[model samples]
Target chain A: MPRQVRLRRHPVGALAADDFHVVDVPMPEPRDGEVLVRNTWTSVDPAIRIRLAAVAPAGYFPAFGLDAPMDGIMAVGEVVESLAVGFESGDTVWHTYGWRDYAAVPAGAGALGALGSLRRLDTAVAPAHAYLGPLGPMGLTAYAGLFDVAELCAGDVVWVSAAAGAVGSLAAQFAKLRGHTVIGSAGSDDKVAFVLGELGLDAAFNYKRGAIEDQLRAAAPDGIDVYFDNVGGDHLRAALSVLRRWGRVAICGAVSQYERDRPAPGPDNLFQAVANDLTLRGFRGSSYTDRMDDMQRDVAAWLRAGVLRHRETVVEGLEQAPEALVRMLAGGTIGKTLVHIA
Target chain B: MPRQVRLRRHPVGALAADDFHVVDVPMPEPRDGEVLVRNTWTSVDPAIRIRLAAVAPAGYFPAFGLDAPMDGIMAVGEVVESLAVGFESGDTVWHTYGWRDYAAVPAGAGALGALGSLRRLDTAVAPAHAYLGPLGPMGLTAYAGLFDVAELCAGDVVWVSAAAGAVGSLAAQFAKLRGHTVIGSAGSDDKVAFVLGELGLDAAFNYKRGAIEDQLRAAAPDGIDVYFDNVGGDHLRAALSVLRRWGRVAICGAVSQYERDRPAPGPDNLFQAVANDLTLRGFRGSSYTDRMDDMQRDVAAWLRAGVLRHRETVVEGLEQAPEALVRMLAGGTIGKTLVHIA
Candidate 1:
């Protein structure tokens, strides 16, 4: 028997542990061309809250059905049984089936636009769990957002919202490493210290203190050239006001809106895009699978060189995955949040 | 004395005649490096509503002061005196000083980012009034928005909101002429008829007739690739829902938000941009003056070959400029709305 988490009910407002239930289920068999994975480390991303809605936003991942196994989450594990070619019984791997102990997944199929395709993990480059963070989707997200979507120009002034979170920390560091002026904004003063002291951003602010727009204006007196948006709503509004002419906003996620009982209307000042010749581009890490190799190569090299840093708030068991997600969404955890369920 | 239409007070809700007053002022004399012109035709654009606000959206043309000459409007006239270089008396010209019978304008000064700068017009290509419609700012707006901002790709199904109006009509026609399937959405059935019949768009819809989203889906059964957003709000919401993967939105203007008593929140489904890899880029025609020569060259040729069709909604005098704007904003008129002021 294997343990798994199921959606007990859709979250009404802030996600609570009561919204999910842990269940003991019989092991699933690997079909032809499928591999059985014993999930060891599963991701707890703020983006998952979007799927917990009754009906997910249009063009997003489908909503999680009531009393069903949660899927489409990133996980790293060991291949237990292989009916698929090129997969060995003992190889470490990553896939898009998580919040469960074991999964029977087809090798060639892609989840989240090939970002979560079943692939063998080169643990030589990084640890198995690293595939769930710095060397994996988060890394690709930060990389593609800065270099690909925002098109980071030389001498650009960059700002990362939720700067101590999974994707934000990496994006801020990448810009800093590239010798650009980088500012970070986080929910707590502790996270702001982490951004300034650990991640080494040029300026870091605690967004919980005062008016976001005023704080951003104070941090960047002149204005920002690029905004990596992880918190939508008021955060986006502030960015719109502080962004200079021809500014670019890479809309990675809207964590602030995800936990709300109802969807918040988008920023009122989106008209600023026209006023300042700005571009507000929304993107997902999964959308940029083509950049994964470059991201892994550079990020892994940085990690080995002690130039790139990663943090993970780990939970004890599969049953606590729901609690882990709630913690992550509330900004209670810094950097990546994960569940360890051998 | 030269008569000018000056702002009496900023409009509330909908623009009324009382918001503007016609005043007879002392005739302006050309200063050094200036041209004094007797204005002939002036433009009444939906975008002008933005400047009437207490503070216009940032990076936009500054808000018009109470009881001041409404600057930044496009007008064509004949130069009565040329104290500026390269300008001879009796030469036809265009400048930003509109809502007036006479203007003394500097030669090299720019307004609205140089889009409204004083420039001599080649009247032989088209009449002076045509410059205000198909050959002037409207044309540049349509061209720059489609080609530069949206980056229209081949086989792109295009949607233009406010499709029978000044900039919309030209954008729709340009896409149609370029052999792409174009859909036009207007407020009234007659305007829909104008879009389908006169503009030759592939599909046309009356947005007021049904749910905007459903109407857009019905018009573009297969999702649209490019959206020229002249009307922002529910119209933008409809576009976000119906736009396909990798779709693009050129935010040329947000007329729907301009006249509101207070600002409106942007579309709720802007997260669709991340889900579908969409890009929303805002721009003004003046932002791309370098494209002017190309636009004039192509548009002038089309006008000569009898392929490019244009219609003008003419108000009798400068005194009616406010009324013209009111009519245009209310969707009471089609194509270009102009005031014939001598």
Candidate 2:
């Protein structure tokens, strides 16, 4: 028998472990064109919280039902039984099934068909959990947001909120690699040190310290040209105020308000969009699949060149997945939060 | 002697006649490449309010200093003296100089050099004031905001705020000409009737009658694809709530908040931009100079065919320019507000 986590109730404000219940079930078997995978690493992402609501907002991601086995975005596993043409037994693979001991997946049902195709892991390059962090949607989000959405160019001053988080870390490094000056904001002094000392960002600030506007002004001196917004609310308002004429904002996420019962009011100065000729555009990683192959190649090369770094906080066992998600949502995690369940 | 209106003091909240002073100055002789024009009609535009502040926001239009002659966008007059080629003494000229009885301008300096080159009025199609209303930047703004900014298509459902004003009236007609369903919002029942009966909009509402969200939902039962935003507070929030996936917004103005000592907070559900994949872009008419000739030709043809109607609220005398501006700002005037100074 294998254990799986099922949703017992929809969360209201902040998530609690009781919202999920662990259940024992018979292990799934591979059918025709299917492979049985023993998942090794599972990702805990903030976006999954949107689906935990009773009814997802229209046109957004679908919601989860009570008493049903929950699923999320990324999982790394190994094939134990292969009934598919392209996969072999013991081959490592990444899929979109997680929070369970074993998953029976159809051949090439990659990222649960949301990310197009399933990917095989090359253990020689990095560890299995690395695929769930830097090599997964987090990396792709950073790449797409900076180059495709914000249109970052050399000499541009870039600001990334949630600077020590998975996506923000990569975005900062990528901007710096392209000869652009980058400033970052984190929640604590330790994360600020990680962003400034380890990530080698030009400047880093603790947003919890003082006014975001004052910190941003001190960091950039002039004004930022591109703002990669992950934490919304006051960070967004400060960015709008300090953005130069024709500044561009790539709205990646609003993690600060995701768990709140009601969304905080938007920035008061959005009218600045008309006065300063600024552009604020929102995008998701799913829309940029056309550039994935190129992005993967460049990121892999950068990883090998020591220009990019991958960081993860791993918790043990399947039962801890809910706790991991709650911790990540609480803004205590430095980088990607994952659960190692073998 | 020529009578000119000068700024007495920068306006605080809403404009008042006390903020302006009318004075007479000795008539100036035309220099080389100069022309002396007796102004007949002058435009009172909402955008002029941004410059009346003692210190305009950085990167926006420059501020009007105290005691200096105040100038606005478009003015129609007859050239009384010409010292340049391609001009005659009696040629009807349209320049970007206004709030004055007479103006001495360089023959080639059109619209005070802010509207690109100078344009000579052709009175064969309509009256002289028509050039300042529908045939001028008003029409160009509507044309460009729809086709270029919002990318309105034939089958798209469009919502235009401030629909009885100069730009909004033209925008509604232009969208209809392209076979789109147009809805409009005004501040009064008469203006609502004007939009519904005269402009022939698909739906019209007075924003003061009910909650803007309920009104918008009732009008656009399914959803809206394009929003031409002129009133930016609650109206913008309502539009955001009803915009379909991939909907586009052309932010033309925030008239409701422009006169406030502090701008109102923006739409609370702007996060919907992420879930709905909406695009909100701001633009000024000055950026669309290349489309002016085509717009003029099309508007003239529409005017002659009786497909387009020009409306104006004319206040008489140079001393009344400030009164006209105040009336227009207070939303009491319909269509373009102008002062007849001749």
Best by TM-score: 1
lDDT of 1 by residue, B1-342 (tens): 799888888787888877888899999988899999999999999888888877888888899998888888899999999998899999999999999999999999887788878888988788999989999999999999999999987999999999999999999999998889999999999999999998899999998899999988988888999999999999999999999988999999888887788889888888899888899999989999999999999999899999887878999988999888888888899999999986
Provide the lowest-lDDT 10-residue window in model 2 chain B. B109-118
**lDDT tens digits, residues A111-131, model 1?**
878999999999998899999
| i-RMSD per candidate, Å | 1.0, 1.5
Candidate 1, which segments miss by more than 4 Å at Cα?
none
Q: What does the lDDT read for residue A215 in candidate 1?
A: 91
- Which pairs in model 2 have colliding backbones? A110-A118, B96-B111, B110-B118
Candidate 1 accuracy as TM-score: 0.98
How much of the true A–B contact set does each candidate keep?
Answer: 0.89, 0.55
